[model samples]
Target: MAILSALRLTRAPGAAFVVMGLYWGVFAAHVPVFRDRLGVDDALFGTLLLGSSLGLLSTMWLAPKFDQGLGRAALPTAAALLALAWIAPSLAVAPMAFALGMVGVGMASGLLDVVMNARVSQIEARSGRSLMNANHGLFSLAYGLAALASGVTREAGLPMIAVFGGVGLLALGLMPLLSRAPAPAVAPEEGGAVRLPLWPVMLCGIVVMIAFLSEATVESWSALHIERTLGGGAAQGALGPALLGVTMTLGRFGGQGLAERLSETAVIRVAALVSATGAAIAATAPGPMVAYLGFAVTGLGISVIGPMGLALAGRMVAPHQRSQAIARVAVIAFCAFLIAPVLMGGLSEAFGLRAAFGAVAVLLLMILPPVLALRRRAAAPLAVPA
Candidate 1:
């Protein structure tokens, strides 16, 4: 019963998923609309989008710091700020205004990303079980639903800004729930000093980095891959990402239970290998339908890595040190969010998008050694008190 209470308390971050979903689903679908409305060419639109990505990147480092100062209250407030800021750009007032708004959105949403997850970690500690994957899957679901709704809202001639404003208001309404969420068990940056036998934590971060790279590529380019590589229609192209989202969401849902049933090491190993296979198949598939299957496989394979990595970090360290340790891992992972797009984009530019993807596919094999190290550590006997 106490554990249930704690889950209820820590669960406020789930609302963040809704806000993120609303924001991501809407923006991703409406980028072309915004570009046309603003008279910006593809290059300019790309730059603006990159700005938002940059804002998100900025928050990756500050996640631990933000939580240190504000704790549980940070998410809703930041989320509200993010939603409110959309008012300027969604309305299409001016180019400079939209730029400003995107920057603020980026920063707020990015910070909230880390803070909310950190908060969940606190909850997991109190609840004495794993819940991160489910929480994130909920996030994925929210994004998918919101994006689905965005399409409906768009067709109804509703301004994207209005849609965003309404979503933000909903977020505001939910802020109290987020605020009331129980305080997490540890500070956001609690685990800073524990040393491991391998992977430099930073290197482990890099190992996982490629996985993120592939995800970003799919997020940014799946539609294009569908349209160009598979000769699919625009509608089909659009659904490519949706398919990816659905697969990832489902994967994470199953992943949560799987992580519990098996060692995270075994789960991640299989997951990576599966994801690699998916990426490779998608990269080489000759048609749209086949490509999407590959993407789905990739999504399923990659879904568990994030939550598993986080949970492993928590178990590896002393309780007081966990938040910091996980925070460090998050920083590295989020950094991948920043780098993956550019790297994949570059690869896509230098040699077809397929080539870019194939490169990412090849790295999936390397995820094993570090996971094995974590398993060994987990299997070690606890020390007896002196």
Candidate 2:
């Protein structure tokens, strides 16, 4: 009931989240197929994924300007671009071409991500309700469904074009739902530099960054881990990421109500420990069933961490500064996505995928110190300008 109500409040931005999930979910499930077609090892493939850093750069420099210029149209426009951009990699057989295609996908995804998250923060401020968890929960649901569907498609021996085309068209169909009322204008940076609580923002960003890093590592590699490492079939391999998505859906939705009742810092602390244990289990799992169990546990615990971190960042700033603060956090958080594929690849190449996953467990545990710092800072009263 609480999640349903939060979804009602955030339906517009939630549509963008859903669209983003559909693309990435399908892509993640198809990673094995894509890699085989390119005929490159994990290391080279990881290097190719570095192309997304270009998109990260664009998001850092242009997303704010793009958001300001397009206002209400930004979300739909970015959605359409993503739908179109995803077509490139689906068709590319060569490594270089595929890398370039990822650039388009990454840029479009980052722009949409920043705009939608900012919009949600705005809605949270206006409605005085916790909505990010529910919105992100919808993303997980869409991602899980798409991964399951893509797995079936792969088992059917369908071409990448077919799977990607279906997802692209689905994204285009959802564009109208993303349209919404214009946001209230924010002061231009030149108007005056509002003194930001930089330390708190950085702390929250680190939390979000770690959460996404774990997510990206799992999404990009879990399928391969199940198939090659545990001898799972295509459908079984897809279940790895699918289970993560499904459990995350539950966690995020549950976290919606929990956020209102619990201390966000305490929630982060507990979630990190829970997720680390799950990752450790997955790292040492002997079979597909056990790996699924691990992924499920990891998903449930990690789901709320990123949303809680973003919510913390928003609360630490004033209304006019909300967008800027969230954007900063997002920029930092997105570094995880940029680094995850390459880092996981390098780690998997050097050690086995199991060890790579074990490293993720360690990374999850490392976020505690930052959470401690954020807890102290969050205790301080904010100095909002009139």
Candidate 3:
């Protein structure tokens, strides 16, 4: 029964990841339209991404509380369903209305992330193995397929809204499946009640945030950097994101095997070093091809960090206390992700895209120590012989 439950819960996150990919696959081309619809400049547009993060943070805070009465299914359902449900408002021609719609979408996504991830932790506990990386990899793959779909659509000059809205509508099909899945968590937990060592998890949170920020920065800004700094054409520029996504998916797919062969601590340390170097190289690459190579290298280096870190966090603490701990770490990670797009956009606007990626490279370097600590924390306390 737990195995079946794990499979069902696992499917929810993978499906959600793929659907988000589908939406963006065709919708990114509408960036200018979304900008125009929001009545904002590039900087503000970047800042606006915060709405989603904020929505995510807020929902993370509330999901556990809501789950108290609504049961485990509550958070994921809220998270999964609303991302697509509010599209009607998002499609409105007005900027304020569109922004409002984005807020709804962001909040829904954030709530869903909190719930789904919490469920992921639960699923891992029940299954007694590592499944986080593969699940997240599916998310990355969905993101790639979505972006590729968008590129093909753009070449046809289709209405971006039509493509996105169609994708949004298709998300409706997922709701029924999600509704049938068993609730993994019963309630939002009080940080006050958690007995886990906050310092260790807190440290893990910082590293996770840095990794997330690196990923978010590349996801949001790599293509722009390639185009503006490396002189890529429209197609090349567009391909930059797809390249990053594909590389990341491939890296993550391979990460599980690598994790089995090494300690998570050692893997994280090496991966962080490689990622930081890749970021630097990408920032300075003389042309697009080099930049793409840099992006792929960075992807491979960082791919394992996310899943390994999250799994360590889950195993480090007691089962009853895991959700709040995970949430604490997740909130910190979301803050980094939330800030990434805005920060990159502002840096790009003020200096150039190259400078922005250089900043991400620097942040990626900071993750190594904490990841090592998290790994040590997860290892068994050696039993002394009587």
Candidate 4:
């Protein structure tokens, strides 16, 4: 009954995840149109995209203050910002306009990411159920569907304005649902405000970094690997990301069930090994079909590691500190996003994509020791204020 209730309660945060995915999906599919409209070259457009990352980093640093001030209101506020920002690119007439718009979108996305995850942690603590995997799964599913829909609309000659407008409207419609959901009550520190421990938090951050690095490698490079390395055409290359996305969605859903039946550490250990093996297979595959299979296996293996790491971090501190802890870990983990493209690009330029991916496989295996450390510490009591 408790689990059922928790499942029902996930609707609010899950909806936020879906909206986020929808915006990103539409943005990715319409990038060419946006670049053409702004009259920018590939290098210039790439530089503009960096504006989003800057905005993300700035807002993420400020998210804890928003949480402290707004409490339950913070979630919807960020969602509203995202909705408003979603339409910026559609309305841009020049390069500067588009860059400025991306900054807004990035800021809003960063805030939403932290707040929504923190909300899920609060719910999990209160309901005594695992919700992260299900919530994240919903995100991946929405992203896949939205990307497909955007592609179809583009093929049918729809404008970027209409596509982004529709996505913004969908986000607006979800705001009320998110805003009305009450924030879970956190237990007050018995003595005073309790500081979160450092080492465990750093460990969690490291685990998440590795997870994102592996995921980014598969997502960003799989298509190139398929087309260039495996001698496949565009359609076949497209299947690489599609296969990873589908398997990731399925794996996350499965992870939700697995969390109920096994310890978090056990799940992480198994997931790491599976991901490593998949990466190895993908790196060495001679054909697109076999590479697709490898990507699918890798997707399944990595799908749950981020959510599990976040859950473990949340559990390590007092409820009131969950947001801050999550933010700290998130900030560090997100650096992987900034670092990965450059790292993979450099490696691919020098050693080729297959070799780059092979290095990624080795990095995936490095997650196992951290999982073991978490398991060893699971039996120890957290030093909460009393």
Leading candidate by TM-score = 2
- Model 1 TM-score on a 0 to 1 scale: 0.81
Better of 1 and 3 by lDDT: 1
TM-score on alpha carbons, each prediction: 0.81, 0.94, 0.84, 0.81
Candidate 4: residue 328 Cα off by (Å): 3.1
How many residue pairs of model 1 clash at the backbone?
10
Q: List the residue pairs that clash in candidate 1.
A: 9-182, 189-323, 189-324, 190-321, 190-323, 190-324, 191-321, 191-322, 191-324, 191-325
Model 4 weakest 10-residue run by lDDT: 180-189
lDDT of 1 at 375: 73
**Best candidate, lDDT:** 2
lDDT of 1: 0.69
lDDT of predicted model 3: 0.68
Superposed model 3: Cα runs more than 4 Å off: 1-9, 24-41, 65-80, 83-99, 185-194, 318-320, 372-386
lDDT of 2 by residue, 1-386 (tens): 77788888888899899998888889889889888999998888888887776675577678778888988888898889888888898899999999999999889887888788778877987998767788889999999989988899989999889888887787777777888734636744487667777888898889999999999888888999999899999999988899999999999989977887998899999999999999999999999999999999999889999988887887778877876787788778888977887888898889989999999999999989999988887798877854
* Order of candidate numbers by lDDT, starting with the best: 2, 4, 1, 3
Please state every model's RMSD to the true fold in angstroms.
4.2, 2.1, 4.2, 3.9
lDDT of 1 by residue, 1-386 (tens): 53234335556887787677667766655554665677754344445556566777787777667766776677777787777767766876556666777777778888778777767766766667666776777776676566556656666778776778778778878888778655534524443345543344554565456566666667666766676667875456556666667777888878766866898778888988999999899899998888979888988888778777776765666665565566677667766656665566567666876887787788676777777776776787633222
| Model 4 C-alpha lDDT per residue in residues 1-386, reported as the tens digit of each score | 53345547888887788888777756655555665688765446556666677788788778767766787888888888888887776789888888798888889999898788778867776777777777788777776666557656766788878887888788878888888655735545676555777877888898989998888667656766776788975446556665666777888888877877988788888999999999999999989888988888998999988888887887778777876687788888887766665667668767887888898899989998877887777768877755
Give the Cα lDDT of each candidate.
0.69, 0.87, 0.68, 0.77
Q: Give candidate 3's total backbone clashes.
A: 5
